[model samples]
Target: MRTVRYSNREELEGINSRPFLANHLRTEVAVHLHSNAEPSHNARGARVIVQPGRPADARLAQSVLCSMKELIHSVSVYADFTVAPAPHTGNKGENREAKMPSIIVETAFHTNPDDARALQDPVFRTASMKGVEKGYRLFSEGKDCVPLKAEPIDGIHLSAGGSQQVDVAFEGNPQYPIELVTTNVGCPPGWTCTDGRVRIETPDTKPSQLTLRCENAGSAPMFWNTQVVDDDGVKSPPVRHWVQCIRGPGGAVASPGVPAGVEAATAG
Candidate 1:
């Protein structure tokens, strides 16, 4: 299933369902993506769909559940094979016929408002992708889950005519090299965002920094969105930071020591 779903096809059968999923069992670990619905429209969070007796698939589900839980606290994972008719199983032909480990990721419920909102958010979507990718990596590569984090800054009240420094450090496991891409978010004109720049890429090393210059005259808040992009082109969610800039008249700057409520959050 390369896309979300095929509307032209029937529920239980489809003409494009060729090449046979069982034929690719040795080469591909089938992972189906789906969204749920309920009459109450209150079902929320995430759920995992996996057939019983598959230990590796269960592990994959758990990893995804845990990683996503870091962003969405209520996310859940469970084995679902409770179907109808004579089978009475929780899974279907996609995973049931495969010889290798397979799972279905119920990302979120479409019926719920909160889940729908989260589904539309780029940040949340990226996090879910990272969780799924990391889940597979944990099961297949046995690699460590790279803890991607960035520092927040505040009190960037700089002088109206002088330039102020803006630096952010990206830290995580060095084994998994990452490239942090930062872009300006709602930065005003004449108020140079890192000197009229938009995108900055972090070096492929641990504790990399994005050095920016808050130059020119401005009296507005500055926001930036940074994403951790891996070598494989997979990006973690987004880590956002904002600094209230008030270019005072006397050309004097205040050293923003420790932000008020600044905390680090993981990027996709």
Candidate 2:
């Protein structure tokens, strides 16, 4: 999986303008699409071409093209490139031998408002990561996994006040149940843990220390965990092993976190 950002015509030229074509045929590549970065006349959208091989060329090309079509259809944001077999040999030797599947992703248009906004969002950065993951999954596994959605957390508005808390959530195949635990052996004077909950008072005082752990108790388990940091430059120990337990059919378990609506909000 590789991410190549193409912001201008010069960069695109560095790629397309390469003197040698045979040596540059990459098995996988994604060029970030941009319009304004290059002169309008210079921009040629994006193109993905599959070359035919001996025995399985036709079948592989068809499968790849179909998958690309599905990916374009599934997402509302990006446009799909016209996919076809390579036409010219260019400077390279006869364009025979199965050329690896190639895709060029055009990401931005200078004139489009939506494109302008997309460039500024962290979500857009994440989209690139997802694209790379999808490309590898498709090329190797012949299937693409559905991308996970990231929840929006307003970091600026979350206030710790004088208390500290950590939350955990689980969602996946129901067969698995997740267990979360936290241990506080060196907590400050007013900090305590009871019934799987840790409470901290005197936000101004530095904690002697704290530790957290998580584990799953099911056939198939998945784990997810994170940490909390305060205003001071102190690093809190990460909640360890927040494992997901695959419960039996028709089983359920609880998630960690302060009850919903209990979080205090601060002005941004």
Candidate 3:
């Protein structure tokens, strides 16, 4: 068994250092440990124990587990709560496969508020060596391993058309840049705004509509502002526009534009 501890900041850096350790345990250690043990009695195989502190740590653990699954397809997992590890042991006793050489990790310390406070700490430089040592010991003894899934992010809605600007808010790993592109509906493909902000031309022939797309250039969520301007160099009015991408089924989602006369001639 192999045990690993992860920090929120380091995991966010896009490094999967723990998976390598898990691979080492499974191929290098588990094969040998199982081969020497008798087959009639249940023999516990090696496992990977991960101790995650914050929500990000859990996510990183899931990523590491996913990578490990790709390499060692038959590894079992169990999550031992730091607060009550004893209760979970009984639950695992019912399943024989779970009795394999597993790794136990202290993902978090509820007693220490400082560890929990690290979630909001801007300078995430501290390391939880205690958790690491415990996990390593559990993995060495083949005690407890658990599987976990990553959490999802909140959705965003953006609308920019008919001389109206839109702003979209995104929260996630901030290392990535947000790229926004705007294109007019039923217009020439060449007619588009590559910049984050978009300015729409109220077509003389018909009411023109444009779509704004926001995407992350890297592995993090990004945020940007959208501004619309008219040919007269005046700021456009705040119009309620439906974000097509977020809208469901029917195309009835529309941003009713105020009459041209109602808008002030001056820039908003």
Candidate 4:
């Protein structure tokens, strides 16, 4: 849910630090998304890589893979799930180093023309992300559960060290008495989020709403994740809400145009 990097240009934090930070933040499941490639340019499919010999990691991988396979044009889903060893030597990175379950999702092969075109389409990109969300829900909750839905609040403009109370509405007429909580995904360094309870004045007659407070101490654009949890412990898919901060002095928005680090911050 929370992204390690907001832009492609971000490189201040190296790969070795990702797993360490994820562990420090105590993330539930770490998912690294990437596009695949091959020399033959004939290979095509969505693949998930997990740490070797970890059942929990494999379970997470399969759950995500099952949902993603339905929406993507993959020749193979890699049902078995690929188990990857530690990257290089001294310090393990990403999947291998995380304390929690982790997986790498190779959505498609850019090397293949058909897959490359699909990845470029906006419709396809949206659908693919939906699959990942559903897959995550399946893992967190269960297959038979009705996944909760909330639209993402992205690209909010705020001042550095400023706070905002965001009102998020549920997608459908969900049942009452659901609690909203921050997901395992984390916030950027120096940021803080205070979660709120869901309130519905009219029950099923209208959508439920949750008003949460977010404070950004740094001048950067970042996102955090939250999900709806029912009384039975079933969780809805995670929703990533983003905020862009402006410089306090000049009131100029800090652009995500340059590389920067987005480490974990406080959340409740």
Global fold similarity of model 4 (TM-score): 0.43
TM-score of each candidate? 0.46, 0.30, 0.19, 0.43
Regions of model 3 farther than 4 Å from truth: 1-60, 63-162, 183-268
- Provide the overall lDDT of each model, using Cα atoms, as 2-decimal numbers: 0.52, 0.33, 0.27, 0.56
Q: Write the per-residue lDDT of candidate 2 for residues 1-268, one digit (tens) a residue.
A: 8988667857655555432353366534322232334444334322233333332333333333343333333344544433232321122212232143333333444344555554565654354334434444454655533222212221111112222233332221111112223332232222222223323333333331222221222233223333332211112334443332333332222223433333322211
Worst 10 residues of 1 by lDDT: 79-88
For TM-score, the strongest prediction is 1
Predicted structure 1: lDDT: 0.52
Candidate 1 per-residue C-alpha lDDT over 212-250 given as tens digits, one digit per residue, 9 for 90 to 100: 333334466667676655543444456676656555543
Residue lDDT tens for model 3, 1-268: 8876556656533233333444555532211110112333332222223332233233333333332322122111111112222212212211212212332323333234543443233322112222233233334444443422112212235332223333322221111122222222221122222222322332321223233342211121123223233221212222222222332222212221223223211111
Residue-wise C-alpha lDDT for candidate 4, range 107-195, written one tens digit per residue: 77889887788678775666566667767777787452233566675547776534445555555323346666654244455445333
Clashing pairs in 3: 52-107, 77-145, 77-146, 78-145, 78-146, 102-142, 102-143, 102-144, 103-144
* lDDT of residue 134 for candidate 3: 29
Model 2 gets an lDDT of 0.33
